[model samples]
Every structure is written in C-alpha cells, then in structure tokens.
Target chain A: MVFDKKKSPYLFLLPFLIMFFSFWLWPILQSLYWSMLEWDGLRAPTFVGFRNYIKLFSEQDYIIALSNTVSAAIVYIGIMVIVALFLGFMLNSSILPGRAAFRTIIFLPVTVSLPVIALVFFIIFAKNNGVLNNIISTLGFGRSIDWLGDPRINLWSIVSLRIWRASGFYAIFILAGLQSIPEEVIEASIIDGASGWKTIRLIVLPLLRPVIIYVIIASSIWAFQLFEEPWILTRGGPVNSTATIAMHVYRNGFQFFQLGYASASAYVLTAIIVVFALIQLLINKGK
Target chain B: MKKVLTAAAILLLSFGFLSASGAEESKAEGPIELSYWGWGPHVVGVNETISPAFKEMYPDVTVKAEALGPWDLMDKFYVSMVSGKGAPDAAQLVRRVSEKYLISELLYDFTGFMNEYDGQFSEALNRDVLSVDGKYLGIPLDYGPSALFYNKPLAEKLGIDVSTIVTWDDFYELAVKISREYPDLYIMTQYYPAGTWGSNYYRMFMQSAGANIYDAEGKVIRNNQKMVEVLEFLYKLHADVKTLNIPVNDPLMWEESRKNNILFYPRNSYFSGEMEQQVPEMDGVIHTIPWPLWSEDDDPQYTGNWGGVALVVPQKGPHADIAAEFCKFFATNVEALTQHWYTTTGVPSYAPARDNIIKDNTNETFAKGLMEAITVREVGPWYYTDWAQTEKILGDGLDNMFGGKLTPAEAWQWTEDQLIKILGR
Candidate 1:
C-alpha cells in the first residue's frame, strides 16, 4: 500500500515515533514528574513539589553516596587513563614484540562478565585464604587485614577491581588512537633529536587529546553509573562507604520503594554526569 | 454460492458446538494449573514433594513452582503488580518485603483461608504483621529465631560451659575467657555492623532487648538508652575485649573461621542450613543453644528473628482460590510439613508438624535449640518502611565503632542523628 510521496516519509517514521513516545520520551517526562512527588512504588504518588530534591541534598546518606561516587571517578579515571595510555604507548611501539597477544591480554577483562569479575575479586580480596592475602602473608605481612570488612579500605578495594576490569577496554581505544598518529611525525621528532619522553609529552599526547577526552567522558559516565561491582561485592557496605549514587537509588527505589525520592536522586546524578560531560566538552574546545 | 455459504455456516456452527461441549467437559473434570514463585532449592524440594501429594488429594489441580532468587522474584513480582499483568498465582513473600506489596493492595487477603487453621500455627504471628487495616495479607510459612551455634569440640577443650551462659554479660565474660585462653580460636564473629547500620544482629539484639528503632506508633526511637546500651555492649565486645571476629559474610572468612575452629557463631535457624551444607565436617561437632539474654534481671525473651517468609496470593493472577488452597495445603498439612522438615531445613510454623518434628528429633541439639529459640519470633513496626535507610545508618555507626573510628556513644549519637534527620523526627 503506497502512500503519496510527501506523506510516505511520515508513514515510514510513524512506528519509530510511536516507540519513541511510548518507551523513551514518556518515561523521561514521567520520571521528571515523579521526581517532584512522594511515592512508594506500591501506592499512588502524592504531589510534594521540590521536597524530594530538597531531601536528597539535605540527607547525609545521599551526600556520602555522591562523595563516594566522585571519589571513585577521580581514583578510577586517574589510574585507568594513565595505565591505559602507557600500555597503548608501549603496544603501539614498533620495537614491542607480541603486540597482538598483549592487546588480547589487555582486552580480556572486558569480555568477562562483570558479576563474575566481582565474585573472582571477592575471593581474591578475601581476608583469609584469599590469593592476595596469601601472597601478602607469605611476604611477611602481619595478620590479614579485613579488606572488605574495614569501611575505610573496602571502597578502594572495589575501585581497584573497577580499574582492573576497565583499563583493558580503554587501552584498546587508546591503542587505536595511537595507531592513527602519523609515523612520519614521530620520525621527524626523532630526527630533531627530541628525547622519547619529549616526543611522547609534546607530539603523541597532543595528537591523542581527542581520544583522551573521549575516554574521560565515557569512563566518568561509566564510573558514576557504578552499581554491580559494589552491589555484588559489598552490597554497598562495610557501612555505606562503598555505596555510590546508583546504589542509593537502587536501595530507595527497589528495596525501600521510595521511587519518588529515588527518581529525584537519579536526576541529580544525571545532572552531575551532564555537568562533567560539559566540562569535558569545554576541555575539548580548549584543546 | 448460496448452498456453499449454508454448508460453511453449518460447519462453523458444528465446530462452535463442539468447542462449547469441550469447555463443559473440562469444567466437570480437568486439571487446574496454579503458578507458584519462590526462591531456593528448599522451596523447589517442598513443592516437588508436596505437588504429588496435593495432586493425589485433589487430582484436578496442578502446582507449578518457579524457583528464583529473592531479588529476581522481587523484580518480577513488582513489575507484574505494577503493570497488572504476568503475576504468578502464588508466591513466597518475606516479612522484610511484605509491607511494600501489602500497602499497594496487591496481595489477596488470606484471612478466611487462615481461619480454617486457627490453632495450627506453632506461634501466632502478630496479626498486624500480616495485615493492612483489618485484612490479613499472607500466611506465615517459617520462623527465624536467632541462636548461638557453637563448636562442641572447641567448647569442650576450652572448658567453657555453653549452657551456663544465660545473659549477654555472661556470654561476654565467656568470650573474653575464650579469647584469652585460645587466642587462635575466636569465640564469635560479629559481622553485623559490617553490613549496614540496623544490621540483622543490631535489629535482633535490640528487638530481643525490647527496644526497636520505632515505637508502636511509628515514632523513631533509635536514639533511646536501650540502643545506646546495646551499641556500647557491641563496641566493648569488638574494640575492648577484641573477642568478636570480623567475617562479614565472606566465603573466605567462613573458610578461615572453620579452619580456626570458631567456638560460636550467632545465627538464625535459616543459617543453620548453610552452616551444615557448606561445612559438612561440623555435623556432630556443632551444637546450638537459645540466644543469651540482655541481662539476668531482664525477662528471658532471648530471641529475635532475622528472616521469615509468608505465602501470599497475588490479586491479579490466574487462580487465587486454587493458590490459597495450595498455600493452606503447604502451610498447615502435617504430612507436607513433615516431608519439608526431612527434605529441607525450614522450621515449620504449623504447631502439629513443628511439635511432631521437635518430639521426634529431641536428640538433635540443633532442632531443639531452634524450637526453643523461635518462640519469641515476631515482626516489629520497624520491619516496614525506610528500614533499609535505618539499616544503612546503623551500619555506618556500627562499622565506625567496630573499626575504631568512633566510640560507642559517638556511634549511637551518629546513628541517632542520621535517623532523626532521615526519618524527619
């Protein structure tokens, strides 16, 4: 059944429009509406304008979750970017042997299931008979510290796992960026008697700025959305020290059924991510 | 064309009549399918055994049990309830998660069905726990009463009289003594504070001591003197006495504790299954006793619950009456509960079944202890609404106190402050 040429485009687009409205756009608007109300997912929502948003900022739990997420972003991104870049820099070098094998090894973690990774790390980080603790004990480290039990250290342990899981994927991206850099430029720099460090600092890094920005943007978003690692490993505990904003939203929404407040917190988290992304854009513009 | 149309219409009418006759036939004699959602092998085993028995009793009804983890079941339950679609006819609901669903009016009230077994349950659950307004919401399936499970061999070697410790203070002294004599073998693992504030241990201890986070009227009472006292007691155990080991539910910790021959592990009846299953070597070596009291002067209500589930029929499901029938069959039938006790490890809440199991297994220390302990099992007001947040607050304070970051007073104060702020009290 053919439509007239002008109407055909609209006809072709109708299914997508219907889906967009029903699934995506409607939920976004509904969640925004929900953010202003007081709802336990079970009962009908009560209108309480701005109260949820106010409570989110005022509550200590929300603040702690936010700060933990920010800390994770800083710690995870810093280690991940530096390590991925170094690996990329090495793997891209003509002098390196078995580059493909190294690349595969680096990217392997990305392929493993996140929950499985969390479980494996949970075993490794176990205070007794754990692979890490055993190794540390053999090296004459005193009694095994309760790595997951101690609130002060558990978040860092979770961060380390996140770094381990993510660094490989980011390395491949950077490797691609490194490969795209012109060979002639590196040779020219060498001919000018520039030191290896100088060549990397000035030429290689400058050329890889866009890729670095991309990594930072993607990773920071991923970092802020952290739930599974901490949830499976710690359940956001040893206290809520390891809890992220995502975990808090999950607790409020699912466990407690305070969906309205959860929606408010979620929007605040989205705002934080957007602001960070915008800052990244500014940095990209400056570069 | 007229002849052909008449023949087609006659054929369609005949088919319709046959379909109508088939429906009538099935109405007289056909199997009724009922869907049940539950978690774990215990539920599966019970359903598997009970289904055949149930079918034998009522040959027309079929019970289909879908075993899933609690979280998975909750996800499906919530989505189905909200959407008014895809709900199973029956499901197991934990007391911890009952309020949210009950408040939504999603559950079919089982009051009438429950009335049939008025005197059957071993202990009558507070009606308010399974009720919203005046309507009973679900049937209590199991009881979770906290108890001290100890290693008999280790206790014997240490010269500790396990039965003599009747109070927390007495238990504390025993812990100190064990820690002093056997530094290698920790007496107990207090992993509660590690999970979250208002952790299971804290909740259980507080409830056992007759102090809950909220009063009957639903006012925040977490900052009371009783809570402060309990927190101080836990802190002293962890920080000063240094008798409490930190396991925090880790598999490695369990392994290490087993290797070190931990003398005591405080847990509910439900956890005994795990202890026995995961570390089968401790079968004859382990013994359980009723939880110690807060003080000798205080009353001897020495138990509090950690986990208990109820059988609830969803309002929007295929067969509510059949589901209720199955629930009654599962909950009150002596044969079913007896089979359940033998096959799996839930302490049946039905009096006849529970009493029979207890009488038959009087020699089993674990069963005896569980029977003695679960009598005080009750659901408090704090079980519902913002309890998770309270748990988080309690968790942080408990962790800080245990980790040497805060004193007991400070921890209590911190938790109180958070609760006051969050609860808007």
Candidate 2:
C-alpha cells in the first residue's frame, strides 16, 4: 500500500490540532460569545449585545483600573529597560571584579517566588515597624511613611515590586544580547578612534534593539495582567488606587459572579495589550 | 502503513481502557463518600468535628472535608457548578455572597429540611437572608453578632469605664479624652479609604442606626439621613480622635492591637477566634462589650453583622439528598454544633446549640453582648447580587470623606448617584 505524503502529514498534525482547538481556540471563542451575554456563570444567559462592554466604559472602577494598568506598565517598561541595560553592561564588563557574583546577586530575585517577595515587601513597607520605616527613623527622619496605605505612593510601590522581580531576569537577556555582539566589532570601533559611549550609542544599542523590544513587549503584556502581587499586598485597596484590568476581571467574575461582564473586561484588556504590542512593533519597524 | 495502523489501534485501546476504568470506578459500590468544602476555622470544624459526627450517624457513609482559602473555595465551587463536575457535595458559603449562588438556581432546595428544623436556628438568620422566592437554599451555621472588643488593661490605665459608654456620643467623648491624654495611642483602628473592610465598617454603623444600603424591600436607601449620619460620625471619629487609619483585618492593625496601641476594636463574634489566633498574648488583656447605640433614645438597638458562613448543598452534586442531610445535621445537631463551637470559637446560629457550647470569659462577654444587642428582629443588611459593586462605590466615597475631599453628606450622595448609574437600580 502506498502512503500518500499529504494525507500522512495531515494525520501527523491531527493530534496537535485537536489539542489546540479543544483547549485554546475553543475557550477563546466561547469567551467571546459569553462576553455578549448577561450570565452569572450558572444562570441562563440573556442576550445583552455589547451592554456589558458599554457598562464597562461607564464604570469608574474599570476606568481607574485601566488607567492604573497602562500607567504602571509604561513606568515598569521604562525603568526595567534602563536598569536591566545598565546591569547588563556592568555584568558584561571584563574589568569589573566579581562580575559573576554581581550577576547572581542581581538575578536572585527572579528565582524567588513572587508571593514570597510580595510578602517580604509587605513587611518592609509596613507603616510603623517596617524595615524601611525603621531605617528612616534611625536616620533621624521625623515620622514613618505609610508606604502601602497612601494612594499616591501605593501604585508606585507595586511598580517598584514589578521592576525588582523582573529587572534582573531581563538583565540576563540583555547580557546574552551583549555577549552575542562579536568582540572584534567593539575592538575595531575603538581602534578607529571611537569613544566607549559613542560605540555603545551607535553600535551596541542598534544591535541590542531586538532584545530591548522583546523585553518591553513582554513586560507590557505582563503588567496588563498584574494581579497576585497587588492582591496579596494591598488587594487593590486604599480606594482601588492600584486595581489592574486583570484584578477587575477577577472581581467581576469570581467575587461578583458577573461572568459576562468579566469576560468583556478581559477582551478589552486583550485589545489594549494587542494595541500596545502592535504600537511597539510598528515603532521598532519604523526605526 | 501497517506500523501506523497498529500504533493507532493501540492508542484507541488505551483510551478505551482508561474510559472503562473511570466508568468502573464510578459504578463501584462501597461506602458513600461525600466531599465538603469550607475555609478558616469552619473548615477545621467540618474536618475534625462535624465530619466525624456525620460518619458516626451514617456508618455506611464517609465524609471528606477539604479546607481551602475563602476565596479559593468559592472560586472552585463556582467553577465546579458551571462545569457540572468535581463540586463538593456540601460547601460552606459566606452569607453575604450566597445571594449570588441562590439567584443562580444551582443550590439544592433545603426548604423541606429547613421547615423540619424551623425554630431551631436564629429567626434573624432564617428570615430572608438564605431564602429566595420562599425556598431555603442554605442552613445557617453561624451569625456574626457584633460587639466592641476593648483592651481592658489599656482602658483601666486610661481610667475610662467602658461600661459607662451607652451611646455613640459617650464613646466619641471617651475617644476624644483618650486622644487628648494619650496622643500616641489610638482609640480604635478604622479602614477609612480602604476597600471592602471600609465598606463593611460603614455598613456596620449603618445597621447600628437601623439603616442599610437597601431597605427590607431591596430599594436603594444609601443616601438616606441614617447613612449620612453614619458617615458623619465616622468622619468625626477620624478627624477629632485621630483613629488609626488602617483596615481592621490588616496585619498592621492586629500588630498595633498586640502592642496595646489600639484601645478598642468594633467587630463581630467571628473575630473572637481571630483575636485568639492573631493576638494570643492579649487573651486576658482583651475583653468584649456591647456595641454602643447610635443615640441615647434609640430603641432596641440592633447589632450589626460583619461576616458569617452557611452550609449549602449544590444541586449538581452526586448525592444531593445525602449532602442536604449532612448540611442539616452539621448545622442543627446540638452535639455537632458543640464540637463546631470548640473548634471554631463561633457563635452558633442554632439557638439551642448556643446554650450547649461552653465559653471563656471573652466569648461569654461576646455572647452576652450578642443577646443584648440582637434584640431587634432583623440584624443587618441583606446582601444582594450587586453587593460587591455597592461595596466598591461605598468604599470610594468613604475614602473621599477620609481624604477630606468630600464631606460626609456629599460623599453619601455621590456614592448613591454612582450606585444608581452603575447598578441601574
């Protein structure tokens, strides 16, 4: 019997296709459908026809959550890129003593569990007896600051946590990009009377563009979905100051049982992330 | 071609075998196993006390009670209900949020069983909280009868007699005196400008004044005089006495209480367990008193509820009847409830069981306060489907008030307007 190559290939792909369709594609389609209904997860759904989406736009909490998520993401990506790049350059320096030790120390937070880190930060940011406040007081600071309680500073605190957890991990990626740059290119540039800063600005940064773009896009996506840290630390509190779109989705779906509304919020979040990633890609391509 | 066909046949046979194995396991006859889900001390009660008692009553059946985080338990249960699989036969659900499930029609109707056990549980809990269209969907496990948890040592040190505080006016005066004398120590911690806990605190005061976010008819009463008054009192407490601005449930607040920096804490009976667990050193140092009345002339001052849980049997569970029976037994059996009390330190909603459970001085004080303050037939607000949304709106308004951006009346009006716009009610 002759085995038809086309049919054989189709058969080979069948299992993966089935799994993907069942798990990923089906859920996305179902969520999209549910986004237009007014169901409470178990109740018979009513055809709401974008009513959930309309309501979401008018809801102040959702607006605040969207603003917080976008602002935090922008700040997070900006700081993470700069800090990671700096750390990456420092680690890549041959003249820097204990380079391996410094890399390990900086990258340690990446290996630590996020909940543990958030909890540790919770203690550190405690208003009265926290480590940070204690240090401030010892340094003759007049009073303890309510780091996690103040609405103005709470979102920044969450951003600091995101940066701390991820900067080291991204720095390793940056370090890899730096290592991939041939040593000869740098040596030739220096031989041709190029300053160190000039070489990095004109050569290293351009070459490192792909890694930086990837980091920015990945961090933006992650920031839009930020939940566990703020949840464990502040629970998006001090008046929803740090509530993210993902947190709003969980609240609507699980806490409020507004599954349809939650699905709508989720789709909006997806759109935002997509638009953000596309903008970054377009900018990179333009450059 | 032959090799591929053989591999496909083997895979098909393996799938068939696995399917057959699952079917056989389902069909296997033995002792019936019922899964129960709960959280916190109630889960402990179910696993250690209630489940054992249940098994003793039904020797042919076994009960497996799984303890999960409060939010995790609800999330898992809701998912299981929606998927129609892997749900616990019986689960403990918070009374406030149970309305969402009740409206979903996914809960087993316990009306018949509830009727049989009528007059056994507290009338306040059974009135309309767990009922929908006259169908009882859950059995009341406990009630969070509210009270004041005061630091006895600190009160004595400040020469303040908690017994003399009858009205909120007296309480406020005492708070001011404490602020004047001990500037470093706060009279109480308040969750102003915070999330659900702040809303809860605001609601507690509202209930104390015989007002709530909704009336008995389920209409919005959030902008009423009583609500504004509650907010006004809270604002005054914060502005004048300089109450520690922290969530009562926060670890920082508990730490402050442990350090004797907080002189008083208004909380429900469920906090009795929390106090013992969170601040064990304050076992004797802390004591309970009835919550002060809203005014001197307020008749039959009602205690406010903070948190309570009820046992529910899901309609989709494998053994609905058995689960319902188990829930009834767990809730109404004096012996099981006595065990529950020992394990949870909770005030049983079953009135008869309340008498059987032994208590320490603090718990006794809490119980006495509950009996005295719960004189009114109805206790607290009936949490509706939009309760979570209401909480967010109210919390935001409280934050504004505490932030000095809005007055109490302005905040109350803003919250009501926002609620009307969002909830369309």
Candidate 3:
C-alpha cells in the first residue's frame, strides 16, 4: 500500500499535538480569560476588565515581588554565567587532573531533588546550631549570623542555592562549546604571540557566545520563576524580602483565593520574561 | 487501512471494558466506603481508632482516611473544592479558616443532624464559632486553649518559680533575668522572619487582650490598641530579651529544648502532642502552665485559642449524610474520643468525653492544664472570609516590627493600612 507522506507525518505528530493543546494551550487561554474576572475560586466570576491588572500593578506586595525577582535574576544570572564559564574553561583544559571526578562532583547537586537540597540548606543556615554558624563561631568571627532569618542575606542565600544547583549543568554546556573550538586555531593564536588569556578573550569567547546566550536566557527565566527554594527555606518572609513574583501568584491564587488577581500577576510576569528574552536576543543579534 | 481499523477497534474495546467495570462497581451493592482527608496526629487517630470503631458500629459503612501535611491537605482540599472534583466525603478543616468555606457555601449543612447533639460540644466553640445563622457547617473536634509548656527541671536549675510567673510583666522580668544569668539560655522561641510565627503569637496575644483583627460587625479594626500592645510586647522579646528566633516546627526548637537552652514555649494544647511525639524523652521533665495574664489585676484572665480542627462534610460529596454521621461519632462518642485523646493527646471539645480522657491520663500536667484552659474565659479570633489575608498582613507587620524596620505603633498602622487596601474595607 502506498502512503501519503504529508498525512503520515501529521498522523505521527497527532499525539504530541493533542497533549500540547490540551495541557498547555488550553490552560494558558483559560487563565487569560480568568485574568479579566474578579472571582474567588468558589463563587461566580464577575468581569472586572483590566481592574485586576491595574490593582496588581498598584499593589505594594506585587511591587516588592517584582523588584525582588528582577534583582535576583540579575544577580543569579551574573554569578551563574561567570562561575559556569570559569569551570568550563578549567575542565576543558588538558592539564587539569582528575577532571572527570571534579565534573561528577560539580554535577552531583543537579541530580538530587530540589526540596531535599532546600531542606539540607535550611538546617545548615539555622541561627544557633547550624553548621555554617557553628564554623563561623568556632573561628571567632563575631556573633552568629542568621543566614535565613536576616532579610538582607536570605535572598542571597536563595541565590547561592540556585547557583550551587545549576552552575554545573550550564558549565557542562559551556565545556561542550569549548571542546568544539579546534586546537589548531588555538595553536595559531598562541603562535601569533597572543597570550592564553588574550587568545581566549578575543577568539574563544566570540565562538562561545551562542552557548553563553542560551545559558543567560534560560537561567533568567528560572530566576524569575523561582518558588521552591524560597518557599521551603524562608517562605518569602522577614517582611517579604525574599518573595518572588511566582510566590506572589501562588499566594494570591491558592492561599488568598483571588483567582483573577493571581492570573493577572502571572500574565504580567510572563510579559516581563518575554521582554527580557527579546532584549537578550536583540543584543546578541546586534553583536 | 487494515492496521488503522484494528488499532481503532482495540482502543474502543478497551474503553468499553473500562466503562463496563466502572458501571458494575457503581451498581454493586457493597459496603459504602467514606473517604476522609486530614493531617497530623488526629488523622492518625482517625485511621487507627475511629475508623475501626465506626465500622464496628455501622457494619455497612467503612472509612478510608488519607493523611497529609497540614498545608498540603488544605491546598489539596481547596483545589478539589474549586475544581468541583476529587473532594473527599469528609475532611478536617481548621476552625480559623472554616468561615471562608462557610461563606462560599461549600460545606454540607449539618443543622438537621447536629440539632440532636446540642450541648454535647462546648458552647463557646460550637454555638459561637462553628455555626452561622443557626446552620451548623462543622463539628468541633478539638479546641486549642493556649498554655506555656516549660521544662520543669530547667526552670528549677535556673532557680525560677513557675507559680510566680502568672503575669506578662512577671514573665518579662523572668526572661530578662534568665538572659543575664545564663547567657546561652533563651526564655522562649520566636521566629522573626516567618510570618506564621508572627501571626501565631499575634493571634495568641490579641485574643488574650479580648480583641481581634475584626470587630463584632466583621469590619477590620484599624490601628487597634490591643494589636499595638501585642506588637510592643513581641518587640521587647525580640529586641531586648533577644528571644531565640527560630522557625516554627523546626527541629532546632526540639534540640534546644533537649539541651535546656530554651526553657519556655508559649503554644496551644496541640503542642503537647507535638512535644510528646518530637521529644518524648522529656515527657516526665516537662510540664505545662496557663498562659501568663496581661496583668495581675485583670479580671477573668482570658486566654487565647490558637489552633483547632473541625470535621466537615463537603456539600458536593456523594455520601454527605453518612459522612456527617461519621463526623458526629468521631466528635461526640466517648469511646472514640478517648482513643483520639490517647493518640493525639489533644483536648477534645466534646464535653461528655472530656472527663473520660482526663480522668486517668498519664500526662497529668498536660491534662490539668487542658482542663483549666477549657474552663477559663477564652477568646477566639474572629475568622472572616478575609481572615487569611488579614493574618498575612498582620504577620508581615509584626515581622517588620521585630526586624526593626517599623516600630510597634508603626507596624500596627501599616498592618491596618495594608488590610484596608487589600480587602477593600
């Protein structure tokens, strides 16, 4: 029997298309509709137009959440990219001993569950008997620091957790990119009296731009959508210092039962993330 | 074309078989199974003791109790209620948040069934809190009367007399003395960063002062005097006495208790169960006392109610009547209540079952404190539909105050403003 190529391809894609429409597209459209109404999950929804969006913008808690999310994303992406690049270069070097072991150790955190990591970090950051505080005190480094309790340091602690868990994964990607650079090109640069650092800065970095760009955009999205670590560790507290935009959406939708407001905040977050990705793409395109 | 036809036929046959089995199961005349959802030791009690006794009594109705963490249970229940699917036949709902469910008309009206059990449970809980417009939506399972759980050996070692610490002023003085005398010892555990701890303490103190975030008419009280006082007291503990600020339910609290570095935990009746479960080694050494009064001369000495759970049957459940009967049995039956007390160590709100559990209890200090707390004049927070939001706002304000970002007065005002803005009240 003869098969129609076009129809056969579509038939093969049918399952994936069905799932995508049912789970992803349908919810997105439904949430957009819900974003226009003032409904607690239980009651009849009343259409409130853009009032929920207006109120969301004017909300102090939403403002704080937005600011926290943006700042954390900036800091998290910056540190993650730098650390990943350095580790990638080190691992790619032929002279580094036991590179495989270092790679395994670095990538170990990525395999463990996030909640487990957060829980372990919670104990380590405890005020009195925490390992970190105990070590500091043992070294006579003044009083015990409240890593999770202090508003000033709690968000940074969350950022540190993100970096610890994710930097290695991105480093692996950067290492692959580094390996793709031919040895002959590097030798030519060195033979032309270009020092190692200079050869890398002018030559290696330009070729690795695609991988770095991917890392920055992906990590940025993750940073904006951060929830589990903050939710488990600090619960966005000490006066909402560590609360992110995603936490705000969960609190409003599930905890406060304000479905419309939560939906509005969520869409706003989506827009911000889109704009960020676009900006990154445009910057890369210009370069 | 033949392959496609065969695949389609197989899929249709499979679905037909699935539907046939589902229909057969629905039509079969078997014993009814009531699904219940809850959390903590109470759920353990329900699964272990209550279900067995209930099965023995009914002979036709069986219960399947599923346990989850408190917040996880609440989240699952809320999602089920919202989606109008996957809800249990019966679930344990916190009394403080039950008003929201009541207002949403999600609970089965138990007025008809509960009328027969009038005066069986405590009037303060059943009549005043669990009912709305004479319609009963839930049965009181337990009442959380606040108390101070202290380490008796630690108190003796510090030369502190628990009897003299009857007032808040006295408690504060004792806290200061303990801080000065034993640099490593903390008087209590308070978490400044977590809003839950802030709200818990705020609710305890506010109810002790005979006030709440809401007035009698359900309007939020702005710049409440009682709230200011409570915040000031909490601030002093956080700033002056340097109370050990640790997250609630953190393992560190238990570790500190074991080491005698932390002496007092001002918690509710449910905490006795927690202590028994978490630090069982300190059972004989630890004792409970009534919550410290606001002043020595204050009349009646009202204590605050912190946490309690109620058994509620959702309106959408398939077996509402049977579930309500099970709930009633769980709450009121002496045998079931006794077993529940043994498992949970929680003071049941059912008056008739009270004496039975309290009479021969091994933990006499806890039992006595529970009895005193129940008999004393108590004030419970007014849980409105917006109570969760109000609690969060209040908690954030308290967090700011304790973190030194706002003064007590400023925190009170900030909380009031936030509530007004958020609730549109």
What lDDT tens digits, residue by residue, belong to model 3 across residues B308-388? Answer: 788898886778778988998888889887777666666688877887765665545432355554445555544444666
True lDDT of residue B382, candidate 1: 39
- Candidates 1 and 3 compared by DockQ, better number: 3
lDDT of 2 by residue, A1-287 (tens): 88897568756876775556656887899999999999987878998999999999988889999999989988988998999999999999999999989999999998998756865786788775679889999999979888877888989988998898899999999999999999899999999999999999998999999999998998888988988788767778767887889999998998788899999999999999999999999999999
Q: Cα miss at A82, model 2 (Å)? A: 0.9
Worst 10 residues of 3 chain A by lDDT: A14-23
Q: Write the per-residue lDDT of candidate 3 for residues A16-69, one digit (tens) a residue.
A: 655565568868999999999999889889999999999988888889999999
Error in Å for residue B82 of model 1: 2.4
| Full candidate order by TM-score, most accurate first | 3, 2, 1
Quote each prediction's TM-score. 0.86, 0.90, 0.90
Listed in order, the DockQ scores are 0.24, 0.37, 0.39
Model 3 lDDT, residue B67, Cα: 87
Per lDDT, the best of the predicted structures is 3
Better of 2 and 3 by TM-score: 3
Best of the two (1, 2) by DockQ: 2
Alpha-carbon lDDT, every model: 0.74, 0.79, 0.80
